[model samples]
Target: MKKITIIASLLALSATTFAQTWSVDKAHARLGYSIKHMTLSDSEGNFKAYDAKITATKPDFSDAKFDISIDVASLNTENDMRDKHLKSADFFDVEKYPTITFKSTSFKKVNGNQYKLVGDLTFHGVTKQVMLNAVYNGTQENPQSKKLVAGFTITGAFKRKDFGFATEAPATMLGEDVNLRASGEFVKE
Candidate 1:
């Protein structure tokens, strides 16, 4: 009986110390991208709907699991015609592929607050491994909800041609590089 009690107490302690889940605060997050338009200037757009599921074993976010998804139909370039064109078969083909998703395979700390997040990104019927340079923007207790929250900013660039997004638009019309920037905040659950 004494041995059983000791084992139970140890198990309880471990669970409290290591098990934690964090959920993305969608209201405070933004996923956006910028690309050169016709070699003239950069055009920026954002997705209106997205969500994230994050699990962390450490407060500094080391050895964390991250998954995020963005609604392809929610993409907006601020122009009605342009937005529709982007969602058509030429671009995202939202009717066929409705969401762009990422599932982290690894997270490695690169210095103080910087980390490299390696993940499988799926979009437009293609899946590829990508890496994002991430900066942990620190964490604090939210004054409104009184919950512990952490924020991160991540950036990466990829070639549109690599994902089969190049067939419709020529290089002269749309730049090959598509740059992404995301700011996400997760509240400890």
Candidate 2:
């Protein structure tokens, strides 16, 4: 009986000290991107529907894993015609590739509150390794929900041609580089 009680206590303690899972608060998150248009202006857009989760064993999140998926059809740039064109065969071809996903390979601390996130990004029927700069915006307890939450801002850039995305578009019409930015609050799960 005594041994059983001790074992149970240890298990409880380990559970609290081990890996923790966190889910993004969709209402407080944004997945956005920007690209040069006509070599003159920048066109910006965002995916309204997406999901992300994080797993971490360290308090500082130095050993964290991240997974995210974005609904390709949920993209919006506030211009219906342009958005439709972007979803067509000239670009994303949403019907063929309905989602864009990323799974982290490594998360290494670069400096105070900064980290390098290396991951495999699958987009437009292609997968490639990419690195993003991450800033850990810290954690806090929600005043109303009383749950622990963490904040992060991740940014990266990739060439559209590299992913076979709208490869036919000339640089004079649409720039090749796509800049990505995601920021959000994640709730402990």
| lDDT leader | 2
Compared with the true structure, model 1 gives a TM-score of 0.90
Per model, state how many residue pairs clash: 0, 0
What is candidate 1's local distance difference test score? 0.90
* Cα misplacement distance, residue 160 of candidate 1 (Å): 0.9
Q: Candidate 2 — what's its lDDT?
A: 0.95
How many residue pairs clash in model 2?
0
lDDT of each: 0.90, 0.95
- For each of the candidates, the C-alpha root-mean-square deviation to the true structure, in angstroms, is 3.0, 3.6
